[model samples]
Target: MEETLHWQPAATHTELLAGPVAEAVRALADDDVHVAAIDPGLADTAAFCEKYGVALDESANCVIVAGKRGGEVRYAACMVLATMRADVNGVIRKRLDVRKSSFAPMAEAVELTGMEYGGITPLGLPADWPILVDSNVASHNRVVIGSGVRRSKLAVSGALLAGLKGAEVLDLATGA
Candidate 1:
């Protein structure tokens, strides 16, 4: 077994970790995904990568999304490079068959997905939510994703992330 990280809790850890990101990482019970709790509350992916020497391309971000459509409102758990932006207009709308797609409000992002706005990941998304991943992300053998809280992150296999419940492998983001 890989050495699991013993993370020191952040001030907001208890409140946020108990939500979506936690569920997502926990869902990897049968897989090799590992969630590491860290205390760098303000560290962006680039900073994290520089500090830990993690490659930016290999560090993925799980973005909790909600599409408020005309008749088909929906949610999605998307994974992309920490440096790139998700193609919300092109990829998400086409797939969801919705008139519009936008990032969910902070309250909704937290309440519905059980995750904080700055900290969301596919691992802990609702089982019915769709998961869209950038094709580049899928090419990596392993990647790191945010935990429900800003203090933690999950490292997982890119090829297998979509196999988890409610995950859909799609080209949903732009280049890194």
Candidate 2:
């Protein structure tokens, strides 16, 4: 096996506090990456910032789901910030068009994302999935997201990140 990164580089996964967080750290890379752990669900991006001493704007939230309209099936995994919410009823619904749209269950989410229920990252998502990224994320120089586990997160630049992930940036998400 590789010796792994010895020092904290400019871009690499951080520490492993064990559990899902640890798994995420390993998932990010060998070194130069940093990982932060906080409350579960990562529902509160601001809180995560306070706890980890990382900028909220530099953090990213991974959104995953499946869309079905008639016999057509579309898998979408979006990465946005806590500042904005995905337009589930607007874009997602109209795009999927099943009379209604809702979030996928934990089991389905995990199965579809290939990442943990609470720690789904857009980086490693299935290539076929239509990764939607918000334009807002591009405003920020960098962002953070799950390393495939709720207990861990990885930071990366918005431009470099979205491009690397092959994400399609759009006004996909709208507000309530």
- Top candidate on lDDT is 1
Sequence-dependent TM-score of model 2: 0.70
Candidate 2 at residue 123, lDDT?
63
lDDT of each: 0.68, 0.61
| Model 1 spans with C-alpha error above 4 angstroms | 1-27
Error of 2 at 85 (Å): 0.7
CA RMSD of each candidate after superposition: 5.1, 6.7
lDDT of 2 by residue, 71-173 (tens): 7666677767766788876776665555666677779878766667656776656666667777777556667776666655665566645564457777765
Q: Largest TM-score belongs to which candidate?
A: 1
Each candidate structure's TM-score, on Cα atoms with residue i matched to residue i, is 0.79, 0.70
lDDT of 1 at 52: 65
